[model samples]
Target: MATYKKRGYKPKKEKVVEEAIEETFDESQSDVAKAFDGLDEAANKSEQWIEKNSRPLFYGLVAIAGLILAYLLYTKFIAEPTEIEASNELAYPRTFFDQAETAAGVKADSLYTLGLEGGDGKYGFLDIASTFSGTKAGNIANYYAGISYLKMKNYKEAIEYLSKFSSDDELLGPTALGAIGDAFADINQPKDALDYYEKAANKQANDFTTPLFLFKAGQTAMQLNEFSKAESLFTQIKDNYATTQIGRNIDKYINSAKYAQ
Candidate 1:
């Protein structure tokens, strides 16, 4: 009770600390205003740099556009027309090839020679393949060239031309594949030869060529000591083309394969 009569109020120190904090905040606001002004100046400089460099950038873009247009025009106007002209020039060689197919011995040889010789000029077979590579006749000439090369026993050249010749005709396509097998066989690459013969046999599957190639493939497999493969091929001919000449001869190969095994 005696202490309560003398009690009096006292101000807290926290109000002074709050006043100091408010003063620091006021100073920090001025610094923030100065930083924003510096950012505005940097933005102005960036705009100036872009404006100064825009003309060169636009010129570079225009030059690239012009190069693309020139290339397209050159391909369309110059390259395509030249190809058409070259294809027209290959007509005679094609005629000679057709004639050679029906002619016999010396006459066929002469026509084939003429075809090869005539295909040599500026618009010749070689030129047509090189220049008018898009034409059908050019491609046909390549096939003829390969066949001629094969007959001449120029196996390497035959392979080159035949590799380039592509067709969907059932007879010619398998025949060409068979010729490649023959060329490989001539060079004594038996494994590669066997592969191509099998490919030829399976490609078109005609009674004329398929059984013949299958027989050849079986023979090649026998040469390579692959008795099981040879037996399989022979058995396929026996089962699939039993009336064909190769089919009739299949039993001999089957026996030979079994003997080798």
Candidate 2:
């Protein structure tokens, strides 16, 4: 038996493998090309949309800029100048108010009247409070007017002006509240007096106003026959404000409230 060999024979398996690798490379190239085409289409759409809305975008930006400019102009020209003018106007009334605090009886009353009503072509606290309503000096005018009314024994007007005044100041805020309490007490409203005294005490925790108002609140509570509340307030003074003059003398008040209870 004999076997015959054919010359120049090539394997078809290697050719099939080479053809598959070429096909895979072509498919990868096609995918990359499709991705680039998609990106280009998206960019063209974005540019078209921006072009269509460009006028509206520009107008919106311009409107925003206009508002900012208006605010700046108003703050610089109108508001700042008004504030300065209001402050200058407040000085005249303030002098009368300060002098009234130290003067006696008729002299004090005359100064207070001058402070409230104005003289020598200058504005008074009442006018400043009304005319410059939103200014800092105007706010201070309200406080001055309220105290003037209180000193003049005009309890109703005192309550009105003091109630209108608002502040977050450590000293002034509590003092205003305490002054309201004083007005209420003078008008024979012990309950309202106690309430405002409590408010004043809790408005801000400081050495001067806190113990002062707390002592007043305790006394007012005693007047209303709220002995337990009075005792509690006195106890707070003892615990927190022992260095204060009122706090040093708080024990007697505490004992009185407890005994009453």
Candidate 3:
């Protein structure tokens, strides 16, 4: 049997399937076009917002740049020069202070005075502390001045200067705190002495300052009739710092504190 067919003819089912595929493609293309239109609209809005805010953004950037420049200039010119000058000025006073530490009687007092008051047109610790307050040298001047006052038995001034000074140095920081405690103890403020002594003991735990301050705190606590705290601190010295000088006698302190309780 011979099947008759027209030219370029397809089956009915094939024609129907092709028509559906073309319609689906048209719908997918329409969806893609809609998505592109939505993206373009959003991009236009972002551009408009950026354009509206461009002047403020530029000024903000300029402000940040100006702050950076100002900081650099200050560090290079004012801060660096002041630090150098303060260090130079500190040398003169430090010499007298060192001499005073080894001297005795009226000579020691005179040297300390010179250290505080300055000579030969050089600035003293006091002057450096006031003039270059933000500099490292100036900050150390406060520590020196405080120690001088402490050695001079000027307890009030010692406390004042020591309180003004701060440091993160393991030795210096704890030493300064302990010095303040010494001042408080000399002034008969047992509570304040105990407080500062404890702070010094805990500031940075080490072999030297830690046991030293702990012993002082224990002694201060004993004075305050805080027998338990005193006993605990003394025990810490006996346990941890047993090789140190104060540690050798810490057992007696612990016994005394325990008996007092």
Candidate 4:
């Protein structure tokens, strides 16, 4: 028979196991504490930075607000009042332009001269155009100056002022465009004249100005020996604007172009 041996716990090995577990738990606790400390330092630094920079950012915003207020005040108090004053001075020139439109030759010349000289006088049109370019009167002055120059046969000056005169009114817009065509025609640039005349004709597309400019365009094309283009323009006017004077005469223009060809 074999005798059974008794199993016994080893005190030294148990103590060594307990010590290893204690050491591992201590290291884990230390690592957790170190992580928490690092997070606290980062939060403190971020707060410090925000505290240091907030005042400058706030002042910068205030400065921008002040500048905006200053600009608004300047425009309202200074620029707008000056523009109003200048607009009041344009009445004389406008009246003269209306007069010149109805009159002819000598009468027209006198009216235009008055307009031009008055525009340069104490309550001059130039003063309004220069000082109150934001006003309707200023824009009209540019138109008046351009038309006056055109009447004087100063094509270059006419082009300059006409180019400056902008309008949304359909009649005036087409009229200005037509005047440019007239100027180009006067300068003997037939091809350029044809282009501008076509532009004027097509600009607003009304019965009054459209057929008239189209007729002028056709004539210009005929002068430039562009028979096909002249024929096309005259045909368009005849087909689309038959009741108009130019449209009624368009057939004659077509016949002339065909004969020329």
Among all candidates shown, the one with the greatest lDDT: 2
The runs of at least 3 residues in candidate 1 whose Cα sits more than 4 Å from the true structure, single-residue gaps closed, are 1-88, 98-111, 119-122
Per candidate, the number of residue pairs that clash is 2, 0, 0, 2
Between which residue pairs do clashes occur in model 3? none
lDDT of 2 at 7: 85
Distance from true location, Cα of 111 in model 4, Å: 2.3
The lDDT-based order of candidates, best leading, equals 2, 3, 4, 1
* Residue-level lDDT tens digits of model 4 in 120-214: 45455555567678777788778888899899788998888888888867799889988988998999887777887898888887899889898
Instruction: Name model 3 segments beyond 4 Å from true.
Output: 1-39
Clashes of 4: 2
Candidate 2 — what's its lDDT? 0.95
- lDDT of candidate model 1 versus the reference: 0.83
Top candidate on TM-score is 3
Ranking by TM-score: 3, 2, 4, 1
Supply candidate 3's per-residue lDDT for 229: 96
In order of appearance, the predictions have TM-scores of 0.62, 0.83, 0.87, 0.69
Model 2 lDDT per residue over 133-237, tens place: 999999989999999999999999999999989999999999999999999999999999999999999999999999999999999989989999999999999
- In candidate 4, stretches whose alpha carbon ends up further than 4 angstroms from where it belongs are 1-71, 119-121
RMSD of each: 8.4, 4.9, 3.5, 8.8
lDDT of 3: 0.94
TM-score head-to-head 2 vs 4, winner: 2
TM-score of 1: 0.62
